[model samples]
Target: MLRIIFWKLGFEWAMLLRIIRPCSDQRVYYFAFGANLSPDILRLRRIGVYETFDHVLEDTVLNFSQRGFYKNHGFASADASVGDCVYGKMYLIRQSDAKRMDYFEGVPFLKAHAKIVQQVQGKPFYFYRSQIPLNGLKPTQQYLNYLTHAYRNMDIVPSQYTEALLATKVLKTLEPQDQTGVFVRHLSRWPKILHPSLKHYEKHCHQLVEALWNRSLVGWMIRV
Candidate 1:
């Protein structure tokens, strides 16, 4: 009966623990493809990132979302499209720090939504993308400068990112989505077996695999 209820709720018992435990020694990896790539901006914003790295998430495209950028007349937010690849920085942050960063990025709020986790190497890395609702709008000079500056500094400029950005254009829309996210909107068909509930456990189910890796009996293989 307990298992049936958990299954019907489409979550595991572990979700309750996740709600209660906001702090953990296990830090998570976050990919920042947008303005958050700037270390100076990150510090100024005081996002509390534990450590940062330059990384390229393969097979994802980048484009602008959101209608405005701060005080600028037209500012676009960086969002990922499904097809191409995007270059950006990765931040290793604690659970608490991650929360602050997400809030600043409008996670679960604004046009941008919560992080959609992807894997790098072998661990989990959440991605944050912005959704822009207006069309024919361009980014302000200052906004472009921030992105270009960060790209050059991060070695992303020499790559195809700049050219790709030059080609991508915004589309016009009558109504804007409140916070319809990149990953969440399409997650209606996600694997039912992997959701979180109040007392469930597959995220922790792997015992022999991890133990084998630790004992040199097996190696860590990255699926992605």
Candidate 2:
């Protein structure tokens, strides 16, 4: 019951903010990888894209090292490596949208903002990196489907890279240790109640992290 109430409150609060939030004219370049590479996902997330270009990050490799919302799989993160490259779309988006993205990415917590300056243009473009990197992880097949869909639908990324991603191993089933996965799996028992409960729990976690970063002295120091 409390979860449902919190979920309702959070949903209402988000809607209110969207109604009153001022749009910023300032724009910045953002590098998209993993699930973010999908235009459909971007649209669903309500991230506006002014323009997009196929860009490559030199000396960086894509890896599934970031623990995902579900314990059974991991999410993509860019890791620095010699003689490696990560190819993806660079989007020009409003600065306001970028801040909104910070919440979704769990910035200053699960992930952190990172940038690379282009040698040719001398402009910095931003990307997200995992705060903690773990090895020997695989992404879920459903997550990989988003990347493959983007690769096929966008026709921007190289074919070889797409094939490489397709060849990557995926987790076939959720591990018993995956708490969120287990919660979701049992949703069929009471979807109307459990679904909102899960959503509220996620919203509360995000709020807690955001509040800690905004109010703590350590967070201030880190921001500085």
Candidate 3:
């Protein structure tokens, strides 16, 4: 049946991606400003941290503009803004761990694989930015809680910065009949058939975005 063929194709594609995916053995500095800021969350994600430091990304402002898988909520994104800065912790992690992070971040799908680099204490640090950003989205309380815990745990200087994060507006409750959740739940029932199709769809989307992102005009528009 066509379903079986697609499933096989999808499985093979996934394997190919894993094989071709570039992974570095060396370590790199990753700047965390979102949920990854929480030590507990980082551990849960299985990213081994070698060291941590208080850092700031200059000429940027933290915004909840990145669309999340969960409807009605947004994830943290650092937008370019003159004379502004986003404070967070810098984590030194293995390159393999960074690849793991890409999976969780929905890289090449929800988020682009493009690295947003900035000078932190005279060294280059990397961070992520959403592939497509929308304005005026608020984070959920649960997401904010992770950030709250992180800010408390790390000694981010200029206490007011963390205070601003705490003050960010949050969606206190998710809808009882969250349609996305329902759809995902139903879709999970037939992973064997659906998984491949879903992966292909993600791959197609990533290719499309990458094409547009490579266009200078389109890329500039996306940043602004």
TM per candidate: 0.54, 0.66, 0.64
**Ten contiguous residues minimizing lDDT sum, candidate 2:** 215-224
* Candidate number achieving the greatest TM-score relative to the actual structure: 2
Predicted candidate 2: what Cα RMSD to the true structure? Answer: 10.7
Candidate with more favorable, higher TM-score: 1 or 2: 2
lDDT per residue (tens digit) for residues 105-159 in model 1: 5443233444678888798988765544444455645455566667777765465
Off by over 4 Å in 2: 1-19, 109-120, 153-156, 176-224
| Cα lDDT tens digits for candidate 3, 1-224 | 23223433443343334345424357778998888888677655556678898887888888897754434557888887899988788898766566556545556333333468766667776898765566867898888887777777667546676787788888765532222221132446665766666545544443343343212211121110
- Rank candidates by TM-score, best first: 2, 3, 1
Total clashes in model 3, counting residue pairs 3 or more apart in sequence or in different chains: 0
Ranking by lDDT: 2, 3, 1
In model 3, the runs with Cα more than 4 Å from the true position are: 1-25, 112-114, 121-123, 176-224
lDDT of 3: 0.61
Per-residue lDDT tens digits for candidate 2, residues 97-171, read 666566556552243334343532566678877666668778988888887777766565678888989999998
After superposition, the stretches of candidate 1 with alpha carbons farther than 4 Å from their true spots are: 1-24, 69-82, 109-111, 131-134, 156-160, 163-224
